[model samples]
Target: MHSPTKRHALPKSNVPAVQPTPATTTDLTGFTPADSSLRGLVGGTPVLRVSQPFTSPDRGFWAKLEGFNPGGIKDRPGLHMVERARARGDLLPGAPIVESTSGTLGLGLALAGMVHGHPVTLVTDPGLEPSMTRLLTAYGATVDMVPAPHPTGGWQQARRDRVTELLARQPGAWCPDQYGNPDNVAAYTPLALELAAQLGHIDVLVCSVGTGGHSAGVSRVLRQLYPGMRLVGVDTVGSTIFGQPARTRLMRGLGSSIYPRNVAYEHFSEVHWIAPAESVWACRQLASSHYATGGWSVGAVALVAGWLARTLPRDTRIAAIFPDGPQRYLETVYNDEYCAEHGLLGVRPGPEPELIGRPDEKEVTRWTRCTEIADPLAPTVRTESIEGGRAR
Candidate 1:
């Protein structure tokens, strides 16, 4: 009989142990422990190479693990937007900072609030994970949940309405308005520079589109360095951001119910709409194989990046941004029961995406790709109207 395969174990450390230092008196090796030091920890995240299972053995992509930052990728934008607002006198000192978020940005805003001495109030909907709500409160952010979604715009718009109400009630309050803010798109310049330094060259950059911040920001900066680089945008099946009809979206961190003005539609070479099941399969696969995974956005982007690795020229270098880690998804994406309840378990994405010519082609319901991207809000494009014939 064949011997049972042995499980690999980590090698024991050989370095001699040093005596523990007291927290009050110990000197940090490379880090300075100060209130201001927290903001300093927001960037310089490392990149990881993912191969095999996710991609062919000889082909892979570089993933910028933005989860390494204190509060994930948005920490960069959260701090930058707040800083710029203060500098421009748009936000007064010690003023209340109000904004709407699904979850990820709430954490970032909380961090920004603590760092900048501002009070943060995040408006969200019922879909936000319980862990995130508690964590935001723990971080000293006031959490406000909208009672219901808007008649046409859904939960995102409902949260926005609540933000407006809150802003009106509080004097000297400022909202980040991440969906349309230029600063949000500009905040990822450092991230793009980091990717260029880490990968040397990037042939294709894949990103998930929510507010269209990071994708637009990073690609804009990277294109300046590598003019020939291609940008691939990933969105959920139900997101209206890519011209799909608005529907309930299960996944968060990416996919918007509204057409965010920050989306650089002209920059995209193609866009993919991924379903919840496909994202679940990808997330699980990444966790089991590479031991590095994130929530919906990460999974969707990875699925697209892996396909690109397999189909693109052998010499092509692809970079995917993982917006955040899996710690916040314990109740949903990573939970077996939750997956079963939502019919998101045991379904594998097709090796190749179904192709379409335009973003509005037949309302994509699975892993579908489109090359002809356009701003759905553009006057030339024909988009269905909502709320008594008002164009969304």
Candidate 2:
């Protein structure tokens, strides 16, 4: 298990610590910050205690700063999957890797490819941010952008199809189908252990569901340690992950038009769908008060986590996973112009959660839930996920 370096330690004053940077010009001092290996820096991310804006009793809620990982939370799974594949002899030495990702997982795959001596090809749609594109290319991974969305299943399915085409063209290519691969779910064991070490006892686990990888992986391990812990799955309003109708989602990384097979829906005690406006409000509030924030999913998870902290018992310990940093979302979630353009700014947070009783229900526009948990796509559509059993 890879243990991340300790970080996000708070000062006695309760103010966010300011990290010192080297001067513009190098001083004559021989002293240097220690950083031995790129792979060594992968895990051991800090768990930050959120202070302001959350007045709930006890440790209000802890934000696991996955952004501290070089490539964010997905990095854990990405590296784990690659290492496991190589160990199992499924990925031959020096074989090229191919996969479909929006950004976070793409970054993780790029890092994994780099560490494992494999070339990487990431297939994504045009919706991918420019900064992510450059970063992936900088990591020596080839970026393949599908020109358009699929008429039926939308961009995600199109990207998967493109991955198939690319794999056919490049012989001996390995595609880590993050959506269905069980390895994706197994990749976060170390993370769960880290959380156990950090908090000791976690009463509530709030996570944003994307490919349903981290939520399923980490929550499973945590549940073993804290059997009474409640797993709260957060998602965007348009996401179909929680049986909500699939529509155009402004937020990335948490919602999927196509239901991912990796979602351990049964593990989730309850689910919440946050709109873009609500996420914007939460992200900005976190930024101004706590000086910590991320993208849409981060904000969504934080919103739900904060609510859990406030509504639950005073002793309840909630841990929310923040997948990455805010730099990538500067032009979107953090940008005033972009938020205004999308009418996502200054929206009041959360209306109410409506009880859901059936899977075929419609017009779910706000927070919604159902007592039962099952895959909405189970009987209707057969998934095109490659590597059905492996964790990637």
TM-score, one value per model: 0.89, 0.85
Query: For model 1, how does the per-residue alpha-carbon lDDT over 104-190 read when each residue is reduced to its tens digit?
Result: 888899999998999999999999999999999999999999999999999999999999999999999999999999999999999
What would the per-residue lDDT of candidate 2 be over residues 256-298, giving only the tens digit for each residue?
A: 9898999987677767777888888888988998887888888
**Which structure among the candidates has the greatest TM-score?**
1
Instruction: Give the Cα lDDT of each candidate.
Output: 0.90, 0.82
How does candidate 2 fare on TM-score? 0.85
Question: What TM-score should be assigned to candidate 1?
Answer: 0.89
Q: For model 1, name the residue pairs that clash.
A: none
Q: For model 2, state the Cα shift of residue 103 in Å.
A: 0.4
lDDT of 2 at 78: 91
